[model samples]
Target: MTNSNHQWKKTALSVVLTASLLGTASMPSAMAASAAPEAAVTTDALKAASVGQASGTIAGTPLLQSYALTDKLQVEIKSLLNETTSEGTRIAAVVRVRSSDANVAKIPDLELRVKTADGYEYPMQASVFNAHAIRPGTTEELNFLVKVDRRSPSELTELVWYAVDWYSYPKKETVQLAVPVKGQEWTGPLSSFANSASSVLPWERSFTLSPALESPLVYTPVSVNRDNTPQGPVTTVKMRVENPSATKEAVPDFTIDGRSNGNGSTDKTVFPGKRVEASPLVLEPKEQRYIHFAIPTDKDTVLTNFNVLTPETFRQLDPKGQPSQVSYNVGRYQVALPVTSRTAEFNAAKPYEPGQPFVFDSLSDTIDPHLSVSMVEFHRHENEGEGYQTVIAKLLLTNNSDLPVPVPTFQTKLITAQGMTYSGNRQTGAIAEIMPQTSYAVSYAFNMPTENEDEQYVLKFTDAKTAAPASTTIGAYRVAMQETKLDVANMSFYPFKVKLNDWTLNARYNVPSALSPNTPISYTYRMKLDMDIARNEHVVVDPNSSKMQLELVDKTGRILSTKSLPFSGVNRLISGPQFIQFDTLRTEEHEYPLDINIYEVITTPTGEAKRLVGVLKQ
Candidate 1:
């Protein structure tokens, strides 16, 4: 796998390099961070990066800093699923610690935790690390290391985890490993919700192979919707037979039911293994055809999740129609696609380079499943170095339109340090057919004069994928400027009423990259806190770049987080960490309501001011 390391996944948003792994199998293998040493801190204040630089943890979360995985100490954590029916924590993790830190001559006590998606914390214990003394800066290699977590068959998102800091020094930097966990979903008791249930066609003998026609089956209704409608759904399911021309085959029956909580419906069928007998449909000679059924979608989002149902007699249980006491205790389920919201975090989207493909996770969007970008171009990169003149251009052309929406196109006009707009297609441009919601980008390289630190350009586009096209200007920068100091006092996330505890976060405005001016730029960051825990009970700040602050306001006029700025704006191009951080602090025992204003000396003519939160320990 190209970028399969656990560290890469956790730190991608902050790290300068983009993850190159395009395929799934070639991704991170980190289960979670290793356990903390007997006396390490497990709070959310560790260093963000260690070796080449990495992300510490998500903002607002309990995790603090980097894990100092020294040369000799070996520690690894893995979330495992419990393998049996016995009631115990089925999903767990294992830890192996050994002496690599020369400071510890013997194995030290270890503390471990398996943090779940909902932010639940579970701690575990395991072996210790055993090693000897080490020379200064010596890399003592430890031997064996592994985590033994039981595997379960039910899990949605992977088990996301990070461990507290380990006090062990000399051996720094903890390793992370992510193990692929797959399991069945949690289906609760159905006795209360199930309206009616039954299993159809449990067994049949197959007689033919290729000619598939119709097979008799049955479906039992399970629950009722809020309107008291039959919750169980009816749908046709196509199947692929392994042995189409078999002399004899066992075909099982299936059923459709609702989810345990009666939210959505589910389908499950009993399987009698290879013992059931069934006959394949025999079609007219040389006449193979497909059949369709009217599966209603009134209460079901997916029409293909029906499961096979079986009777107790198939298991040699009492032939009586009475349900078996223990054999059929579990709820039945089938494969169905559930409806979910379409989302892509705007904070992660706004600042983008034209040439680089947009990172929209469209899996949930109802985009035309077949629409695709034919050409995405950026005529020239907005910012070029000091000496020569450069250009950035692009062309977006596609033929699919199941999903339609107006697309934004950029036009460039070059301006000099003296603030002069010369003749050029620099400001804004337009195109047709690039229908609504069907947006993409393109880019081109440009060379600029050697003395110029940056070039400026404005972009025009319809703000939302709305029908009416609106004109708006977006800035692009070719930053290679002289030293500048940046300061701000108040910061806030409005409309949503940012709690003092949640608004102190900072964002890296520009991450230094090879694509930027090949020169080191000096920058200073400062801030003032309007934090008055004893007095100011409400945390609020100005959201717009007006007489008091900077940046655009949300629809509700509240300012979005600093992380939402367009760090990649061509006219306002920054080459730092892509995102910029003012000062952000976290005091463990403070309930300071967030309310502060932040200002930036971004440029002489143009700049920004914001409101955010800050908390420093006394």
Candidate 2:
């Protein structure tokens, strides 16, 4: 948005015109002989406007330069670092502005251009800023990141700065700084250039959305996934929007456009289908919601940038108490996608054991007395014949603050040692709020290939806070199970003491219409289990929680059928026969191993944590 008024625009224009005329009169004889007449004039004009230009090369400490735009505003180039990578060169500039006592200073729409030795200037491919404005009588850092085509730092002679004037007409006042580049080439990972305070600028493995909104709505990009189909490559971008205001706000109607490359030839309106939420949705005060946008792109397309446009219009009362139409332009916001898609290189929380608590502090500043999360249990149900397994991760979250804390919807992934990643689906227990100093249990389920069950795996969690999205990891565990004979007694399963008293197996024959009564076409097998469970007080227990499961597995370890038994908090005995039936019998053999799994709900200072004590094979 344009920040300056007409008066400031006039003053900036006059300053540039005066400086050009003075520079032309004093043009040097050597520069004029070496360059064309037009080129010489333009170069001299830029040099004259360049105030407080820094000298020497960018080797040790970065050189600082200051530019005075008006009597009230001055911009300081505090530091600069050029990072070279195989794909491109990134320039990080730490900028600060000092405002006069009389007026507040808004950061000008700035552009940085790299000037080559041959006098060619290349505009930055992408850029991001840390802040938008500066307060009066105060100086604040407004750092930014700019990326350009691959070029040796020594090949660049100077940098050109443009302060765009967008009030009435579009124009730019230019300043040229002579920053020589000389030193060993600094080669490192691109994410290293990201500011620790705000990881959104340079782009990190996981980053929060940049604060580019002009309204009260805060939007955060949660995750992006690409799926290949016969039609094309479909990319789904999930975003979380929150309205932390006193008044309800209409969700902005934003359209996302994507470009495959910098040339913009492949630019397309990517998100054609409407969002999952209803159109013209209005968020209640302090309400948060998640929205998904499905973008179908051309085959073999990799979106490098996303342009979001939100055009909002509303009616307001004028001074005369009459309604007037007003246009609120939130303008366009750009997001630069990372060069590569990989798991997060760093974990915000440490790798915790299965039952240990993970105290996450990264969000402490955003949410007072941040909550802690712990892995209570991990369950893997194998359906070998179907070629897939259903894995569930149960977690306990405790709110340590005195006030109630709303549970954040988490995006989860299960990563194996061999680098295979599976996205989790069907999350439960995130709808309710966690009371202060109490724990709440939640579970995430993932359907993965049965072949991956033997591989070591880890669980990753990402919170959906727009301001500070954080990721944590737990595990590197192989499924632990034990085999036992039928009618085993006095078995320990963490918080539960179990005794399998007895079991019965029966088979029923089914006759086909064409076959005789003696000739059975199919067989139905049923197995009944009688067990006793004693619950301990080590963990908080829920009466209606499904705490145990029985699975009948074939000789090949494929589960043929399964049944779940809900824990009856009133009695320790599960006396009635619990039967599991398999309808189809391919062979005459009827014997199969039964696996019994027990679960426990425990209470701690944190939220309720549930545990899958252990699996019993009989």
Candidate 3:
């Protein structure tokens, strides 16, 4: 990498030396070639996409420059453009600046100010990088990321300028720029402008909402003024209302908000799967109506870029703010989230039986963050002893932010026991950061002992984002050994006496336990081998390991391993509409009560661990 940097330096130097190689006029072309196609413009206003701005303070130089074109515009259009935005349009065009008198020793204090055709200019994010040059061609890619809220272009009216302080470059030195541009627009329709290529639309603009509202509700099944109540998980939007009109007595004042992004600009921001409300809009004589209503968003949606055609329908609107505030009595208006009217469900397993399913959202679907959750696979093992059940899940993390957003792999409580919880392996906690809309996947594993015991699990994503009323969801699996063969169970010993009842066993060519039924026997107590078959067809009689074991000896204590046969019903796996089998396992040997030691192990992503399954012997 170091060597590559050296090569790049050499190339840059050679280009500088070539002087005429890359012409000054080619800069714009180069930038265009690197970026995607520019957004379509309908207004004479500048494109409002999140683009980086040039940084640093322009000292003494006027930020706005004007020139009287010898060629007058057939129809002049003045727009007061602002780079502010609504939610979801967070991609910023960062702009940085350094003075021409950059001294390696001193760092300058840089401040940025944006000018509007309204003669208003505001400061942006801090442009802090410092260099020696005070007037060096200051450059920055401004990340003034914001979605457009309104459409009426803030066209470059008369002059555009900014004031900057050359902090360290020269203590109190400052600069500005004032460029002149003859923006033209058509007085009539595009057809008229089409005939006159010299004329453009009086306005061309777009906007989005902040923090982006997802799956917003516009109204109930039936309601007026989009009086939809907010339900389920959602973000909040604060709108500022202003009635910039003279006569507050605008009889029957009406205004509405619209989502300029979807449905070709006619759709309201309030749609299914979202919530909406009407602001108290009234024009008393000359009073302005700045009604604040919160509208939920579906994904990152474009906001109110619609114009207030008339006070009967609209007096003002701003769709780029949170909730993408809109002002219009515009009939058939849309200002709620335009999400899928139908709900989406993710059932972990199917047949859609009685069991639970991991719910993303209710009637209204939940907007999911970029999370890559892999399917959870389950397994059951048995042979030597009662088996173990295991469940595994994983996800990867991606940086999905214009800026770094801290992401933590949190532990959602999974039902461990009746009331026990594994909190998680705190020491080995997972952690990472997701940058501007990135994606990531991480894995967590869990396991437990299962001898037909029903178990449940859970996983929750409680980070800065991905919050909900439940604040969690079901990430569970019931422990059961499927496709099981033999399941033996033992009945209690004869409780009436120390030893009684008819208990017997036949040996092929050896001794047995208790010769009580034998005239002359080699051993006393007999060992009976009883097996409970689960899958009737899966149970087979052969020398295969599928059989049970038994042993017996005389008082001298001679260890003996004996063969045993199946005894009992062919316990079928009992296939049902949904597999729900509950059975037990046990050995059928009474040969002096041999000590049986069983060790159960379950698997998890981290690894396997010993699971205490309780002792069965004295």
Top-TM-score structure, candidate number: 2
User: Please, what are the lDDT tens digits per residue for candidate 3 over residues 1-618?
Assistant: 675455334333322322222121111223233322331121122222112112211111111111111111011111112322333111112223323333322323334344445564444342122232323333322222223344444533222223455456655423322223223211111012222221111121111110011111111111111211244223332222223344442222223333334543344444222113233334444232222223344444544322221111111223653322222121211223323211111123122112233333222112234332332222233333435444333333344346655555444333433433333332232334555654433334444455535434334322212222212222333222222222124221011001112223432223444745563333333333222223323112211111222333323444344323222236321112212111111223334444322122323344443222222232
lDDT of 1 by residue, 319-363 (tens): 775433222222232323232222211111244454343332222
In lDDT terms, how accurate is model 1?
0.28
What is model 1's C-alpha RMSD?
34.3
Model 2 weakest lDDT span, ten residues long: 56-65
- Give the count of colliding residue pairs in each prediction: 142, 10, 145
Query: Alpha carbon lDDT of residue 597, candidate 3?
Result: 20
| Candidate 1, run of 10 with poorest lDDT | 57-66
- Tell me each candidate's TM-score: 0.17, 0.42, 0.23
Task: Score residue 32 of candidate 1 by CA lDDT.
Answer: 26
What does candidate 3 score on TM? 0.23
